[model samples]
Target chain A: MDQLYTPSTEKCELVSASKGTVKFLLDYSKSLSIVKAEGMVFENNLN
Target chain B: MEHQTDDSTLVQDYISGDERALEILINRHNQRITSFIYSKVLDRDAAEDIFQDTFIKVIKTLKKGNYSEEGKFLPWVMRIAHNLIIDYFRKNKRMPKFEGGDDFNIFSVIGDEKPNVEKQLIKDQIDSDLSMLIDELPDDQRDVLIMRIYKDMSFKEISECTGVSINTALGRMRYALINLRKIIQKNNIVLTNY
Candidate 1:
């Protein structure tokens, strides 16, 4: 198994550079999840 | 020392009478905000309308000097847009709501019972910067990362489909993250949820 890289403070500093990008991606993913959930519900309703 | 006027100052200026300030603010955030709305709704026209309404509420709220959180302009605006999208879905009867105790309602679809339009628009309106970063990764790394993220596939599944070992798939994902960090350092990409 590939060991997960634990983000240290220095690594976090590197991450901070793209903090906005990361946060946006996360929010986008979350919204997509909700949308998918809605779709599943819609499909279920149809059956 | 040079004076640095933040978004709050710009908002204050707009509230005081400078149209240019508000214009600058809109120009700065419009694309991300619009893209966010589009991701949720998947309908361009509806997204546009919601985007407009979001700003209209922002303007009205600001004009009334109701915005006390000066440094939080973007976050405030994001909340407005999110709420408006929810409102839109609720009004259209597309959002599922449970009613009449014991009635387990999931997603409510009003009007015609048509096939769900879920599979067509799986692209979650990924913002340009993240997309650029993903595009910059090496092919093997990018492939594994996309399968894990956009497809929500497990590493084993990714390996099965890509014909790579599970360990190799996981390694590729880890390397993708490392490479992404390097790219962010080189390009100075700033990521913000708001």
Candidate 2:
């Protein structure tokens, strides 16, 4: 059983790491998005 | 116009008290964002509106304690923009096409510019070459690179968007970049020429 799943284990780790990274970006982008949106609004109002 | 602050620094400053950090980030990326959205919508006005909405979505998420500073930031916003465009299409039941891989097609919207004849000639050569190269790429490789570089999507989001596996997406990009390099070398054009 151990031999059968060893490669799968490594791949799972890779997938998990990638998933973690994606989650972080999603969260960070969510925070930064507001200012961007608001800035555009202010610019549009002036034009 | 330029990236006044690095993205990481901008985020940190925003977390503290600098009101302009967000503005800096927006200015740094707005042109890229605009072009990506324009690629999808093929309508300059609607692209501008979607561009605003994508940034707005980013801002609102940041304030609500939902932001996590992980992985590639540009790709995340790109995914949002892509989704919004897809949603827009769903509502209208229409899809846009790029005719004959014309890279300069987008530039027409930003016209009435002064003449810099020498520079324009160089730019025109590069644009035509790039368009030709892209048209010649294998469809899988071409599609992924367009989304990755042009639309600014990450492999994972692209997988979600296209229903392809992540490995497949990355593999396509790897081949695409290699093929593009070969094309550039064969044509004796610098990669930056595009």
Candidate 3:
């Protein structure tokens, strides 16, 4: 997971990025009845 | 003063093997892009699938050194998502079938039957023509028409999406149809074969 700062906040809090991307890839994998993207970009590429 | 990295810079960074840049870019636009897809598909799973597919295409294109949109990243992604949505509809053969309604029925205007190849060709032509006519409508009315007709969203869903009352959504839809008819007549574009 990549640590990124909040864009608009003044405090500059650290946050874990790619949560949505991970979930999206997981959902997509499930939809295709696959465990993961395998050799695709999302396989171990996301947090 | 805080400085924000623009999308083009982020794209370049991601292309240069900085995966964190891609994460930031995805996180930044996730909600808007996902919501836009969901509004069109009206299904969470399908929306997520399309979103994933959209990014997959983006990554491939970028990796292949074909990322030429530059500053206009979001619009380019949205266009890809829009085409994917059209593909989903085409694969499922789920064209809108409007129920009997008030003075105007959009389905009747753009006949959706594909009984023969000739009718299918005509329907395709009408769809192409209607897409152009739709572009001329006022933004609000166009939004309503797309949500109601293309997205197959109900008035309540349209109301929630547009942050307007259901009545307001319905009114916009009516006006959209009314104006669409007027535009067709004014332009002398025949939408129906009969």
Best by TM-score: 3
lDDT (10s digit) by residue, model 3, range B114-137: 567887788899899899999999
TM-score of 3: 0.42
- After the best TM-score superposition of candidate 2, give how far the Cα of residue A45 lies from its true spot, in angstroms: 16
- Candidate 2, CAPRI quality class derived from DockQ: incorrect
Sort the predicted structures by DockQ, highest score first: 3, 2, 1
DockQ of candidate 2 is 0.04
Top candidate by lDDT: 3
User: Residue A15 lDDT in model 2?
Assistant: 11
Candidate 2 lDDT tens digits, B1-194 = 34645677777676565656766667667767777777666666677677767876776555544568785668878888899998888876655443456465666645668647877887887777787898889988998988998899989998988789999999989999899888888878774533
Candidate 3, pairs of clashing residues: none
**Candidate 3 chain A least-lDDT 10 residues:** A27-36
lDDT at residue A7 of model 3 (Cα atoms): 54
Candidate 3 segments exceeding 4 Å error = A1-47, B1-3, B94-194
Candidate 2 segments whose C-alpha is farther than 4 A from its true place: A1-47, B1-4, B94-194
Say which prediction, candidate 2 or candidate 3, comes out ahead on TM-score: 3
* Separate DockQ for every predicted complex: 0.02, 0.04, 0.05
The true-versus-predicted C-alpha distance at residue B102 of model 3, in Å, is 32
Give the root-mean-square deviation of each candidate in angstroms.
26.0, 24.2, 22.1
Where model 1 places Cα greater than 4 Å from the true spot, the runs are A1-47, B1-5, B94-194
Candidate 3 residue-wise lDDT at B102 = 75
